[model samples]
Target: MSEIPANTRPLEGPAPRLKAPAGATDCHIHLYLPGYEAQPGGPKIPELATVEDYRKLQQWLSLERVVVTQPNAYQRDNRALLAALEQLGPDTARGVAAVTPDTPDRDLQAWHDRGIRGARIMNLPGGAVTHADMLAVEKRIRPLGWHLMVQFNGCQLNDYIDNLQRLESEYIIDHIGKFMPPVPADDARVDDILRLLDRGNAWFKICAGYEASLTSAPEYADVGAIARRVIAHAPERIIWGTNWPHVGVSRDNYPSDADQLDVLLDWATPEQQQKILVDNPARLYGF
Candidate 1:
C-alpha cells in the first residue's frame, strides 16, 4: 500500500494530558485542499491542510468529532468545505459554511443534507459575510435550524452589540471573543460577552488565543483571563476547538495543539471540561 502523505505542516506532537471524552468535538477547524484558488480580497491561502492531516491531530487529542469551519480564504465559495465534509464522513463531522442572505434555499438544504450545521459570519477583513448580513442571513438559515459561527475584533464587539442581540438563530462568538490586544478580565466589554451569553442563544468558542493575545504563549495569561470568565459565566454554552493548521504563524512558532488544549482545560473544572469538550458541542452541532 502507498504510504499516506504526512501534512507538510506536521500535526502530530505530544498528546494532550487531558484525554478528550467520547463525543468530544473540535468545534472549529479549517481544512484546505489543492486546486481551490484563494479568492481576491481574502487572506492568502495557507498550506494544504487536508482531512488526513487533521485525522492525526484527532488521534493525538483523542477527539471523536469535528466541525470544519469555512475559512475566510475561500469567501463564499463552499466547494472546499463540501469536499471536506465528504472526506471526514457525516457521522463524525459537521461543517460551518459561508453563505450570504441571498443564498438559495435549495443550496442551503443541500448543504444541510450533507452535514453542514451552521453558517459562518467572520466580520474581520477577508470575511465574505459580516455583521451587516447577520439578521438577513439569520432569516435565511433560521428555518433550516442552522446556527451562525461569528468572528470579529472583540474590542469592537459593542459596535455590533445591537445586531448580535437581534439575531434569532443561535450564534457563536469565536476565539474567546478574539479581543485584539486582549482585555482585562473585568473590562466592561467582558460584561458585554457575558450579557450575550445570558440571552441563551449566544455561545462562546474558546480557541485560537494566539490570534488576539499580546501576552504570547505557554501561558497566554491575558486571553486566559477572559476565557476563564466566559467559561464561568456559561459552561453549558461553551465549546472548544484546535483551530488546526493555525494560519499566519510560522511553523517554528506554531503552538503545540496539546499545550493549547491543556491551557484551556486548565481553566475549567473536571465537570466543566466534560461539558466544554463533549456535551456542549453535541448539543450545538447536533452530533
Candidate 2:
C-alpha cells in the first residue's frame, strides 16, 4: 500500500499462471536510471525505469536472474547498465553492452569484469553501433568470452548470416530475428534462422513478439509461430525475456510480464520451457 515509485511503469498484473523453474532468467531488459540523458541519436522513451523497479518485476515473475541490455537510448554509454548490474549482484545478473569502435579495450575489459557477457549491436534506427562494428567488437570481446548480441530488422538477417557465421565469437539474434510485417511461417527467412542455429554459431532471444507481430496482444499468434519454429529447431539455444519497459511500443499493446511468460506455455513443452527459461540462459549468460 506504499506509494508507487516515480518515473517508472507498473507491472501489468499479478504473477503468471505458469510457475517458473528455479534460477530462471529474464535475459533481455534495459535500465534507465534518473539523470542519464539519452544521446543525440539514441532511441527515446519517456521517464526512467530503475534497477529497483525491475527487481519488483523479477519477484513478480519468480525469476532470480537477469540480463540488463544496454538500450539504444544510452548509445555507447554503459554507466547506467553497469550500475544496475552492481545492484542486481554478479551471480543473479548479467548484461549486454553497447560500445563504439573508438571505445578502449580497457573499458571493455572493465565491463567484462563487472559481469557483461555480450556486446550489443542495436542495428535499428537511433543505434550508435552498426554492422561494420560487429567484426571489430567480436575481435575485442572474443578474448573475454563475450558474444555479440544484435537487434535489427529481421528481413535483413540473411544478408548478415554468412558474416555472423564467420565471426570467432558466438552471436545472438534478438526478438525472433524480429521480422517486420511478420513473415510467413514457411518464409525463407525462417529457414535462414533455422540454418543459423544449425550452423552452431548463434542463439536467439525469444522476446518482444509485439515488435514483429501482425496480430494483437495477449496471443501474438504470428510471432508465436516463429518462436515455436525456433524452439522446435533447438530448445537448447533459445532464451526468454520480457523486453521490459517495452520502449516505443504503445501501452495499450504492451503485455504484462506475466502474460509474456504465459505465452511460452503455448509454444514449448514444460521441459522445453525449463530449457528456454532456465537452462539455456544458464549456459549462455553463465547464471
Candidate 3:
C-alpha cells in the first residue's frame, strides 16, 4: 500500500495466552468504504475505510468481538455500517450507529435485533444536534435501552453538559472525559459534567494514547491516571478500546502495543482488566 510514514497502524499479534475472562470485547474500532452512501447536499467524510480492512485488523489484534461505530463518513445514511454489522455475525460483533433525527422505531428495532446497541453524537466534528432534535432522537431510541454516545473534547462537553443530560437518557463519554488537568472537580465550570456522572447514567472509555499523553509517549502513566480515577469511582461503568487502525494518527516516539497493554494490566487487576477489556462491552453492546 501507500506509505506515508505517519499513519498510525495497528499492531499484529495474539493475546499472550493470559486467560482473559471468557467473552472479552473490543469496544471501539472503525471500518470504511470509498463512498459511504454519499448523496447530494450531504456532508462527505474526508477519511474512509472498509469492513474487509476490519477483518484483517481483527485477526492481527486478537480481539474476540468488536463494537463497530460510525466514523462520520456515512453522512447520515448508516447503510454501510449496518451492512458490516449484518456480516459480523451476532456472536462476534455489535455497534453504535449515526442516525438521523427522524429515524423510525421499526428501523431501530431491526438494528437492535442485528446487534447495534447505541448511537454516536460527534460533537467535535462540527455537527449540531439541537435541543429539540436531541429530545426527538432520544424519544426514538429510549425504548431500545441504548445510550447516546458522545465524542467531544472535555471543554466542549463542559459547556453543554446540562443540556446533554436533559435528553433523559444514559450517555457515554469518549476518551476519559478528555480530562484536562489543573481543573479542580470543585470548580463550578465542571458541575454540569459532575451531575451527569453522579446520576449514574454516564460512562467513559480509556483510549487515545496521544490525546491523553500530549508527547506521544508509549508509557502514558499520566494519561492513564485520568482513567484510573474514573474506574475507581465505578469500575463497571468504565470501559476500554484500541481505537484500531489508529487512522490518520501519528506513531508514539517509542511505540509498542505490549507497552500499552502493560499499562492497562498494571492499572487494573486481572478481573478488572477482563471487565475493562471484555465483560462490560458485552453487556453494553450485547455482543
Candidate 4:
C-alpha cells in the first residue's frame, strides 16, 4: 500500500481520553483506495484514505467495529467499498453501498455475503440516489435485510416528512440531520426529526458536526446542543461516527479525531455513550 499522505489525517494525536467500550463501532466512515476513480456528478476524489490508515484511527479511538459507507466520490460504483470490507475483515466491519432499484439481485446477494448491511441514499449534490428514488431503492434492498443511510439537508425535514413516514425499511438520518447552517435544538425542523424517531423505524447518527455547524472547534456548541437533545429524547436509537478522513474539510481546518470522540463526554452520559458507541450499532448493524 502507498504511504498515507501526511496531510490526509491527524495520525499523530494523543489517544482520546474517553476510551471506546469493547465492540464499539464507528457507524459512519468512508475508505478510499488508489484504483477507484471519481465518477461524474459527485465531488472530486479526495486524498487516498486507506484501510491501513484507518486501522491506526481505530487503535487511537479504541474502536473495534466500523460501518464504511460509500462516498459520493465513487457515485454508484461499490468496488472501493467492497475492497475496504475485504481489507478490514468481516468480523469487525460492515458496509453501506449505493445501489439503484435496477441493481441486480445477484450483486446484492454477493455484497450481503461480504458483510454489507445497508444501502446509502445521499440525497445531496453528489448523491447517486435522491428522495424520488428512495422508495424504489428501498424496495430493492429491503428483502436483503438492508437498512438505509439517508443524508440530506435536515433543514428540509418538514418537506420530506411524508417520504420519511412512508419508509418501510429502518433508516438512519446521517450527520444529525445534516441541517446545513444548523438550526437550534428547539427549531421546528428538529421537532420533525423527533417525530420521525418516534415513528419507531428511524435512527439518528450524531457525527460530522463540522458539516453543518457555524460554531467552531473543540465544542461545536450548536451541533452539540442538538445532539444532546436527540440523545436525551431517545438514547436507544442513537449511533455515533468519526466521519473519518473528513474529505470536505481543508487541511488547515481538519478536526482532531480524539476531540471528535471526546465530544460525546459533553453530549451523553457514560451509559448513553456506551449505547451510542457500541450497543446501538451492534443492534442496528448486526455486529
Question: Number of clashing residue pairs in every model?
Answer: 0, 0, 3, 0
Lowest-lDDT window of 10 residues in candidate 2?
Answer: 1-10
Worst 10 residues of 1 by lDDT: 1-10
What is residue 22's positional error in candidate 1, in angstroms?
1.2
Judged by whole-model lDDT over C-alpha atoms, candidate 3 comes out at 0.65
What local lDDT score does residue 138 receive in model 1, on the 0 to 100 scale? 89
Give the alpha carbon lDDT tens digit for every residue of 1-287 in model 3: 22223222444555543344556566777666543444433344334555666676556545678888766545566777788888788889888887656787788999888887888776654343433355567767888898777776675565667667677777778766665542343445445554567777777786665554653355566556555666765678777776655554544443444454455665677767888877777677766
List the candidates' TM-scores in order: 0.96, 0.95, 0.80, 0.96
| lDDT by residue for model 2 (124-157), tens | 7887788888888788888889988888888887
Per-residue lDDT tens digits of candidate 1, residues 1-287? 22333357766777788877788899999987876767767887657788888998888888899999998888899999999999999889999998897899999999999999999988888888988888899899999899999999889987989999899889999999999878899999999999999998999998988888888686789999999998988899999898988988888888888877887656899899999988999898887
Better of 2 and 4 by TM-score: 4
Report model 3's TM-score to 2 decimal places.
0.80
List the lowest-lDDT window of 10 residues for candidate 4: 1-10
Residue pairs in collision within model 2: none
Model 1 lDDT on a 0 to 1 scale? 0.88
Residue 122's lDDT within candidate 3 is 68
- Give each model's whole-structure lDDT: 0.88, 0.84, 0.65, 0.89
Q: How far does residue 40 in candidate 2 sit from its true spot (Å)?
A: 1.2
Model 4 TM-score?
A: 0.96
